[model samples]
Target chain A: MSVKLTDDVGAALVAAIVARSPYRRALTPMIGEITRIALANNQIRAALADVAIRSNFEATRTLGRRDLGPQRATLMSFLEYVYFASPAFLASVGEGPKEGSHNGH
Target chain B: MAIEADHCDVAIVGTGAGGGIIAHRLAKAGLKVVSLEQGGRLPDDYFSETAPPGAKLDFGIGPSTVWPADPHDSLFVHPLFADGAHGATPRPADGFRHFQILKLNGLQNLWNGVSVRFCEADFAGWPFGYDHLADDYSQVERLITVCGTKEGIAELPDGEFIPPKPLRPADTMIVNAVKSLREPFSHAIPNRKAIITTPGLANSCISTGICTSGCPVGAVYKFSARLLPEIAGLDNYELRTNAKVTRVLREPGAETVSGVEYIDTKTGERRRLEARFVVLAAGAIETPRILFNSADDADPAGLANRTDRVGQGLQDNPKSVLSTSLLKLWGHKRTYDIGYGDLLILMSRGKLPDGSDFPFIGHAIHGLPDVPHYLSGFAGFPPAVKIRMARMMFHSYVTLGLFCAGEARPENRIRPGSTTDSDGVPQVTIDFTTPPAAREQMASMLKWGRKILRKASATKIYESIDNNGTGIHYAGTTAISDDPSAGVVDRDLRCHGLDNLYVCDGGVIPNLPDKHLTLSIMALSNRLGRHLEERVQSETKVAA
Candidate 1:
């Protein structure tokens, strides 16, 4: 089964992931791939997401204040990073550049 | 993939001092001119006379600021300056938005409003000297609304100007020291600088001490808003923003550039433009990058890189700061102590063992602006302590000794690298270093500054000093020569191997002598504009 992803779904999934685990460098690629596969596979998408959310929620309860500040900035940074890094944004913008940006250096 | 060429009599790149001066001159001469600027045009309201709270990102903090370049490529960015080698891909700056070739985040970087002219001996190695460029310099000075005075020094050129802004008490003390040291055996003059009170921003009119953050009032000349207005009404001129030239297209069987290909920065569209003559005022780094990227498949070494000098011999004016001791002033507190003063000018006085006298550039002892006051106030200093600090500052002086915004040997140089962006345009490798002589001069100047201040009877003096900020002047690499085997462009500024192409920016100064680079750059652009006019007129006659 294939599951279709929407903007809200992507945002919620990212938020849920952050709400669960603090920034583990290892988690980025894992979440990215899992999200991609979930979007591709319809049948297990919602179920897997629900399970991931439950586990992530449990994980968040164990995180302390010491990890919050950087985690938030990093998450904000990651969201911004993801937005620009999205294939959709890149596709619409294409690879061609605008003027006043060339430096050759 | 759509490529269309728009033709013109002359096409100039960039729109700062170099491009703006050239446009004004060429358009005045009745030639149709096209100026391609990568940055978007700012409306009349773009500049705020009020103080800006933070860094303004035209592109992005760095390479990230520019759209369409590889998001990964942050080596080259606008408002260029010296940081590390532009060739070195830097790790992301913490919390900073992006990376760039040069780091110019500071308000006191680059020329920093120093507009002194090149000295004669300083021009010995240059193709022409003050006499050659005098008339043109005057013309450009008028166009830019320069403020300066004639010092009658051989190494320094004088120009038309407003009345000299008098030095503050602190600056006066140091100036007295340098002058007092003069005698038949000594005869040394304090170095000179051009400092003006910007009238644009506020009623600080008594002495609009703001110079670095850009004159809130248009007292000092900034190219975009100040000088361009003089040439705004010319119908023959067209300024195109966001048109980034990717490559220069040459004639099928000739070295002549027929036109250029560019990317539309906003729409991300590819396009082309044609011109009979092209003046590249895209500044030191970008100018050469354009040449490097213009290398056609048939000519891989690059269009103007035959000598490989297209990206060699890069140099920034080497500089060091000298500070004086602080003196206690016994007087009522006044706002004058915390004001910026005029940049004084003088010549080099030392004779080399070989009988050659190196030009000694002079900077006025600038008074401390109100920054410390605000900082101290913020830190909760008592009013009495703040007044005492201001009083001591009133007697302090800092004469920036001239060690040659001096030229450096090209061996201490940077290069253009091969990492092309998504557009296939290569990147620049900007590397530079300070010479031993420059360093020694810095030490000596600091010692001298202290003595000078001591002469004013200072009770205390800070031992530590500033380095006049990182040497921001960038040049060389694509120097002008008649032969393709020597420099990138010919003496006419035409690319040696490619006709109809020219670079008229600071990058052509093979070795920048100790002088403010902007004034010379403006003069050179004026010269290029005149040369272009002559070329176009001759071509029209030939056609007739």
Candidate 2:
């Protein structure tokens, strides 16, 4: 069964996969393919997103520590790593790369 | 797809300030350009200047506010230093010790981003006048976002600069003191730094003050951050990392260089690349070494070493450091040492009491926290009092050194060494000695600095015990001259006999002036790029 996935669901799926699996290098491409397939079939065209995760990056890029100390700095770094790959974020949820199915390095 | 072009419009060696700028200019002009970088791209995380091994954080409880570890073996992410070579000469003197090269990031990876331009008499002996370099200097300054004030001082030519950084409490005191002096021994002009004090949110400097650790925020104007993004995305430009150019190819009885040969540093594969023009920006030492290594069986002295002067006349400025207090100027007002170092260096032309001037000295006011250093300087105090004094005095400190332009003697040269790196590239050794004049000038400059700091408002003084952060401004291995006999390249930096081969880097700087070498190198490279573009256009029209 083809499951209709919204952005919220797709982001959640990505966050879950990245957080649970330490090897994003190995799995991001598969995630990207799953996202591409879901989005192209008009199955995951929802406007909704995981609001908390979206703001996490925007705030982290500005380094709004929220008093979390040094670890927040580390978090900001991780989020920035994801932010630079935001195109990959779209590719994973929207379409796989034209050159390849996986966008993970 | 890999760059499948058999011949590009231009081939450049190394990607430091010189090569990066020239490559950007050439590629932007719609020419296919290939850059041969000896080092690979550093992973994104390596750009973070705040990480461990890259940086440190201690509150004096456990780690005790330690200093950043010197990037030992952390050679330039791109550099001109010859690998697998031995230091054949022993430098026992405190000021002149060893000639070293930093590979990997080149000089920019570890650079502190001090950018200064050469003034009138600074170019006294050159073939071209200052007007030729003036506009290029201004263009590069704006491109890099240099912050400083342009002064009327003739020997110290000023250019278009961003608003100078605000002075720290100590800087204000020193400036006020210098201004109040009867003869005005030195001027406290705002430092010309390649750092962005103000920028778009992405690359702004937060003034973390550990800039030499590397500017993690991209505020410090490194070549990769400033020039690479623009060039790398261009359709006509190609950056081939892990490829070390072994030699420039020229057919028998050919007047122009045809192509180049390089080795893949990682895969150990030999590759040949072709281009209409080959520009060597491999830096002062390595550019010469590449020419020396490019020796064909017919021309055994290397490609452009036809005049036998390819690797001759090596030079570097000798530097010294002195620490002083701005306490007399630091009254009841509270001050913090959190300014970015590359943002806050102040420059003064080193002049003796007799009115003779030496190379200039650019000094930085840092918020360093090394108790042991200050303890040694303030040895007269008791241990506990020494710590307190060190802390109090260190609060308002300025460490500065002079730029004594050393001579480029033929004896001070670079020659192929017997040893070879893993890539089978033969190592090159530099034979240099601090000239007697330079040595005397250094002592005089140091002595003058001591007298001024004492007069200006200094308590305890400390100096660099050895030649540590000196000679990174190495140059003149391939001096540019109108007389082919004296230089390896001509006025336009073209190899004397070859039409298409060029050398732009510190290698083309015939004389070492007391300026941050990057600004001049960039200006020259930009000038060469424009010149090459015009030349190529004219040639195309003639052929058409």
Candidate 3:
């Protein structure tokens, strides 16, 4: 089924996923904007749907989790989309002490 | 109509790895040099780290706004692969799709800068061996400012290098683990990369872990960033961007190439530039395509294809990726400074058909920013569970990339298609298949890689074998050989039948070693420059 990700739905998905992340404060504000831009690519959109279906299969068989169905896939797909597309989110979570200078140079 | 001839000594096509070095060397030696680059110069902020919201990002490097929307749009020759299951239907794969980068600096701008020299064994079938090009290799090393530790491994030779960047904790663990293994499998060394590590020469690598998207600070070696500035001020050197060379122009009834015909990409105007000599460094695929496209009634096959070997013997390193999670580093805080380039070189010795020791090389990469994407794909968990798993396992991720030496076979070749692109250049049809022996070697390498990772306390190992063309280190299209029947070029890189046509790109490489091919291409170009300089001086003396 074709799921149109409007700004409100994308924002809701972003809010839900960021709530579970450690960098919730940093990612919550910017992730929706990033996701909206990424979803513009038809290739990425198709890939998201493919990943969602495969994720559902893995969850049901391997993890023994109840099939949360399309809603669950939608939420997981949005999370996957943001994870791959949003470098800002990656940078926020990966922030750490920069090595002052490499090899004492 | 053809434009008026401009005075030029040497006209080089493609301002990439080979062309860039050749232009710099020839220009510095006081010879007039002109380089034609298909793509124009990128903007100053092309590699900037910040992007406006709603901009597309690639691998944590900011907005890819400067890059073409489709990577194939930059290529002069688009490659069609015959990789269908039945092996008859030709289609595009991830490998050839991203193979050629047509920007001013070419693929060098997007390279991860893993600069390792081919070992002595790698020169088995070449007209010249390692010792012949040793000085050239050292010169290119110093020019590019390669960073590594000289471990004196015979299979993986050491080069002139700055101090290597320190290995991260995960890399250190893997290195120590390899130390406990048996001979041949036990050796691991810091990767020798072309990235600048010295403080004063240029901006040093800040370990942003985004080298592939173009180094924002110019720490990584790029022709436009490093060598172009050196030659831009020379009065004898000229670089014409947005000039797409169509073919090498042969002088009537002569065995020498006189000049080149190109299209002004900005205006769609056909132009000709005459020169004393012409060098084709457009790349392995496009170089041969240009030669084939230049075929006429005199040389119906191609200019240098008298032996029908211009596009034969094409090869690319067959690669496999093994991803694993370091059990020891799980739940550790993630750091962005983990080197995006190969952190360490893992060499395993194997036996060739002649019972000679062949070095099988693999690179260990740690803390890639894209780890979470891989995790989210296969984890099969709920959204919250997947997020938590990504957070916890982020620091534990380690990917081992293995590249086997590709054997140059006559069957695996590139031929010009009947149709042409919008610019009137022929599309390329690549008929490449992984040889059975190479496939066996890749399988063996993958198995051995899993063992090494297991030794390093890695869990949940996964292997992904890439399609043949993905290695991107294309070579041996126009191979070098002493016998005219066997190869396209001579030891001096001059085409066997053509007096003034030279090939200084990866096309002249006789074989593909496991290591990256850029540095070797640069070294060959440097050697060619010195040879041409001496020849030009001798000719001038005879004329005087």
Candidate 4:
């Protein structure tokens, strides 16, 4: 089954993945750019084929979270790459916590 | 068309750690130095974080297009390993793919900033000992601003260091575990790195954790960022990028080199640059390749192959990685304070087959940018679960990267390939097999690594052992020795029979140490620079 990486699909996929993250609010603005680039990758495009089988948005979201073997790992790697590359995500984590917070005691 | 270039006091082939430092040192001393770099200069904003996405993105955390993807590229040097019976095969390991970085600053641009000095025992077969290069080491440390603490360990000698970034919770846990070990295993210190830690520095490390991809900030030590600017203003120094050196040209019937022949990569024109002294700092692989390709009627074997040792005794430290999840720090907030990679250095000693004490070192790495990438590799986890795990368990993760010493075997060598490259230089064929002792030592190191992780109460542990040459710390092709019969270069790094040709790269390292080789290479280059400065002065005085 071939699924075209359209804007709607890319946005839905990126949104579902970002929703799983604790920093979703911070990472929300980056989804559009991340989706544009992530969809260009053949691995991500191929992984979206599994998502196209489901009819509803909730089904697509659940399928993205479910096990798809190596594809799942591929999706996760792309997600992490997006997070690291995101300016918002970097700004949030770049300074780290204040000096007195949790020094492994 | 063949073009005659200007003559200089020294013609250094390569602008990496060795060539960059030597050029700086000589040019600073008022000697005319010309450095030939095969790769062109990268843009000033090449490593900038806000740089536009395609090539910059590939350079940072993606499959590096920064390194030549094809062997046919001018910057690429083909490396082949020996098959069973005289045949060769492309090396299967991906780690070796990063070996050749033919850029203006060479491999230093992609280095991880792990700066470690060779200890007293690491100088076993060399003509000089560690003490001989101690001041040189200190000079390099100060120039690069290495960060760490003085642990006073004999095997892992302390160096001049600035304050290192404070250890994260995961690092502290691992350090305590290593400290709890038995004799010969209790030594652990902050990992010394060539990085700018001084606050308010122009581009200080902000703990981006994406160092190896190339530091966006100029915090990590890179010759392009650190040394190039220093030498650029010198009247005596000239840097010619897109200059691919072919071979050192020795005058007929003379033992000294006359000049060098190279291809101007931009114009595709062959040119000759005459110099009083020729230095090959190309790299361990490319340096030997150039020497072997210089074979002619006078030397027959090669210019420096009077002892047939130009491409012999190649060695690279074998490495093993142990990934652990500290149970106590699970679900803790992930901190972005990775100031370059490894946070702590764990040193220990093990017994060889002959019962001799062997030194081994392990680096504790946490909060690297690729933590999530590693987490994604865990089996049975969905994409969402893995992402959540990465966010939650990032603070708990620690990878112990251990390295064991490699032996300098004559059979393990790099020779010119049957075919020539695009620039007409012979392609490099690296024929090396990991010694059984190295494998055994790696196994032992992994065992010790596991023990430390278990002691730290790691909830899960994973082990991965890389093949030889994966360490990328290649050395010992043009080995140094006092006796002319055994080695290619002598005590002063001058080619055995060739008076004016010298090698100042990792090629002169007689054996591979457990520590990284960049610092030692830089120190040797520093020593060679001082030596040449004195030699030139003395020669000028005698002539006068």
Q: What TM-score would chain A of each candidate receive against the reference chain A?
A: 0.32, 0.26, 0.35, 0.60
Worst window of 10 by summed lDDT in candidate 1 chain B: B52-61
Candidate 3, residues B1-544, lDDT tens digits: the string is: 1122385999999888899899989988988889998767777566653321111343222222211122212111221111232121123553243266666887776677888888787888898889998999999999988999989788777899998777788888888788877575457888888888665654777665545556667788878888888888878888998888888897555798889998887899989989998999989987988888888788887779888898888888877778778888878874434554467888886555555554578788774444233543445666567566666666677778888888888888887665565666666678777787776677767777887899888878777665466677889999999999999999999999888999989889888888788899999999999999999999999999
Best by DockQ: 3
TM-score of model number 4, chain B: 0.90
DockQ of each: 0.02, 0.01, 0.13, 0.09
The CAPRI classification for model 1 reads as incorrect
Error of 4 at B85 (Å): 26
Which of the two candidates, 1 or 3, achieves a greater lDDT against the reference? 3
TM-score rank order? 3, 4, 2, 1
Model 2 chain B scores worst on lDDT over the 10 consecutive residues at B57-66
List model 1 lDDT by residue over B450-520, tens digit each.
55556766554444322322354667767866556767776677777677788888778877776668888
TM-score of chain B of each: 0.79, 0.87, 0.90, 0.90
The TM-scores of all predictions, comma-separated, are 0.68, 0.75, 0.84, 0.83
lDDT of 2: 0.63
Interface RMSD against the true structure, candidate 2:
23.1
Root-mean-square deviation per candidate: 13.1, 15.2, 6.8, 6.7
Error of 4 at B17 (Å): 1.4
The CAPRI class of candidate 2 is: incorrect
Q: Tell me what fraction of the real C-alpha contacts between chains A and B each candidate also makes.
A: 0.00, 0.00, 0.08, 0.00
| True-structure RMSD for candidate 3 | 6.8
Per-residue lDDT of candidate 2, residues B210-237 (tens digit) = 4555566677787678787887778788
